[model samples]
Target: MTIATDKITYSFAEYLELEETAAYKNEYQDGEIVPMTGGTTDHNKIALNFAAYLKFALKGRKYNIFIGDVKLWIAQYRQATYPDVMLIEGEPIYYETGKTTVTNP
Candidate 1:
């Protein structure tokens, strides 16, 4: 389900601060923080199955497949989104020092 916001604008820094403590995930669009909706059971199953298949197919290869929990930081667009699936061939390029966010997929 989607979480409703107050419609007030926020700076990127402010958004990040709020996101750090937010119970649910939120998408950053420019300067707005939009709450993300949860996926259906079918969607979750599909994503997990796809990731599992990729892991099996790419076995012995140098790659990492992430499911829906990781955050993707798009620097150019100033957006942080959680994709259904993400694959990074090599070491991920992290956005910050803690290594919690990645800039490259």
Candidate 2:
């Protein structure tokens, strides 16, 4: 059997099951799966800097800060994406990698 379609399609759950041990980063939008290009040195540095600042500012608080490689799920977009920085407060969602499941910041 062969599948036919004029559009790229994938469910959020199926997207999650893709083999990705190496952070083969990707982003999804409107039923399309787009590979994520690795960030440049400056991009990474900026992300790190922002995460650091959030960490310091939120010390002893319930919230935790994170940087790149962390997946942020936007259900409204039906997609999971990487954000430069994220802050999670209260009961946090955990993923297989021991990071928050989804965040926005």
Best by TM-score: 1
Question: Cα lDDT of model 1 overall?
Answer: 0.86
Task: Name the runs in model 2 displaced over 4 angstroms.
Answer: 1-5, 19-23, 94-100, 103-105
In order, the Cα lDDT scores of the candidates are 0.86, 0.72
Cand. 1 TM to true fold: 0.85
TM-score of each: 0.85, 0.76
Deviation (Å) of 57 in candidate 1 = 1.1
Pairs clashing within candidate 1:
none
What are the RMSDs of all candidates, in order? 4.6, 4.5
lDDT of 2 by residue, 12-82 (tens): 66676662553677787756778888789998888888888888888888886767767877777677788
